[model samples]
Target chain A: MFLPGRRLSLVLGTALAVGAFAWFFASGERNIPDTEGGLDGNGQAGVFAAAAGAALVSGLVLSSLTNALRLPGKPLEIGLDGLNGATYLQALSGLVAEVSRSWRRQIQQYFSG
Target chain B: MAVLVSDYFIPAIFALVLFSLWFAGRDRVEREAHQRAVGISMTALGIANLAVQVINSVYFRPRPFVQYELDLLFYRPTDSSFPANPAALTFAIATGVWGGNRRVGAALYALAVLYGLSRVYAGVFYPSDILAGAAIGVVVALLVSKLFLLLEPLPTIVLRLARRLYLA
Candidate 1:
């Protein structure tokens, strides 16, 4: 059932990862911005921001592929139960739950008072 | 601000990485798998960071402090600023964990951004340098995650040796 999804993820992830790497190395050789004389203020920011965006997109796409490939042939469960590690999801959810529980207690106390 | 940027920021980032490791350790059921994944991710990150160094050597660029006199926090480095090393390392780790857990990945990604911005704010790196570094880190991580299965034999051998020594 999930084979098609896995295959699609594998294909898309590989393509994005390869394409991003190629683009970066191919165009990364330009001379550093001549900001010595303060000629192009923020040029560095602009360039780096664009690069960061590209990197982020590539990373997310590739990560999705990894997840898709890893999670097949198993029951779908959220959090870090996939591999048995304390996943980021687990930590974050725990923190959120704790906070929310505390908040709820506080609200109840206030209303009861 | 200077103290935070110079003295505390790097340590804070390190702490974040440690925290992730500690989090992985807390899981009794998937502990082994999580640790293995972390190991794989970190090894990949090291390789990617080394590649960045090679790239830096080929295309040298001065640090922002070397280029301009800004509010300096730490002693200036003589390394190339084309790709920010800190950004690369942090992003690589983030991307590594991201494959296993999205929420954790997102948190690490946020931390990576903060670290990059702090480097820029400290006038140590240019914005583009951080971006480029992050991009490289991401690419390396993705490749590693995708090809991890192919590299399984290497770890399996290490595990066998460790088991022999009763160290695994």
Candidate 2:
């Protein structure tokens, strides 16, 4: 639920991913022996081609999640009709109240550390 | 004074960033403009990445460290290397996503550049591969974003085509 600046997210995500890839490769243990001396032309080609396929599927999955069950804040649903200052302020205040009620402790933990 | 920034690490870092952007592009977009801009841009670059990779199926360009036996601190790509797909995708997504909120755009660009740097520092890809790929990505994304802007309020034409193409 953390919404970092998009740039930070991209950087952190890339760092995390590269680190994870290293971890996986180091721990995979399956190809180490065969690949140590270096994969032959065809073997290397196969490994990358296979990995590209996996990357494609993974990319698709990241963009298309169903938001039906997500925490609601549908901007489209909240059109400007009757959306004046009082009602909007009330709504925001209510949101703060609800969050404080549920996630106050988590927020405290996040900052206090 | 080029102490590091060898071939292998740079490309590896770029690859990592590309993968991350692809991951973000797939997430549920709160705003359609941001979503479509990022989505089409990254996906296209990603596909371009795949195409370059296919060429690697034959190219097998050696890493600089490997050629010089420098033993840099990074993992080597098993596949052939040319036209670094990862670098291409990272810059492409950054430019594509730049049309978003100003804060968001600046952040994405900075992140993309960092990712690019990490690749060179990692000793994974050649400078040329990274540069060329990044340039292509940025140019294409700019064009694509412009087209999306011109076609906003996504008409029946786009939605219908998207559906028929199974992209929607």
Candidate 3:
């Protein structure tokens, strides 16, 4: 429901996808302790935070990628459960248009009155 | 695999799975329901951690690596080992999500079980410790969910405010 435009989703998703793997590899290589007492409480917290971030990033990337890779020639119809970037953009654009029209009408009425 | 999973992989995946539930559902109503579940799970996780800490303070149990001769795959944790914190945290989240979304909750439960097993395999936690942790997590989640229900409109009001900010 909080989907962004296709282009934005693609870019962000790709970045997040790369970031997730990169973080896992980099952190695993450096922070995983081979010796006892190597990881303190703060270090453990950092690892957990990094893991959470990576996971969230990966999930978002997958969701956005799934929607982006849909057939390009197909109609941009919002499905009943279409909770992707495109649908979010569609809804956002609709909201903006509605708000602008209402504002324009209000202004026009104020001037006439 | 045990080392990597025990260290961070499972927790990472668990967070991913839990958050995915928030993005699920066909409409706002469905999404809101999932969001509520996420909120409850997160809250339960926090409380579960606190509960584990309290237990640790009350009773000190040495880690498996300290007492038994086994190839340890994880770092030596300084905390008390009577209740596995990872197991408890994961189970709390799984149980919390289960009340609203069963499928995702089931996946979370599987992951939680895997996490617990990996910790044991890695020579960090005892099977009994993991069991105790899981029990603590499940009981806390159930209690917290019940409390939320008893609180009624308060939780709903908070969610409404979150919705106003486009959070829910």
Local accuracy of candidate 3 as per-residue lDDT tens digits, B16-105: 666556656767777777888887888888899889989999999999889989987766677789898888888999998998888888
Error of 2 at B86 (Å): 1.6
lDDT of 3 by residue, A1-113 (tens): 12447567557755775598568666645344535445543366566668666865565456445555452322233332333324333433554676799999999999999
Candidate 2 vs candidate 3: the TM-score winner is 3
Q: 1 or 2, which is superior by lDDT?
A: 1
Write down the worst ten-residue block by lDDT for model 3 chain B: B159-168
Compute fnat per model.
0.00, 0.00, 0.08
Candidate 3: which pairs clash? none
Residues B36-152, candidate 1, lDDT per residue (tens digit)? 556656666677778887898899988888768797755556558888877887788788877766676788888788878887887888999999999988888888876776887
Per-model clash counts, in order, read 2, 21, 0
The DockQ scores of all candidates, in the order shown, are 0.02, 0.04, 0.15
| Model 2 chain B lDDT-worst window of ten | B1-10
Q: lDDT of model 1 at residue B6?
A: 43
Cα error, residue A61 of model 1, in Å, equals 43
Winner by DockQ:
3
Model 1 clashing residue pairs (backbone): A48-B128, A84-B30
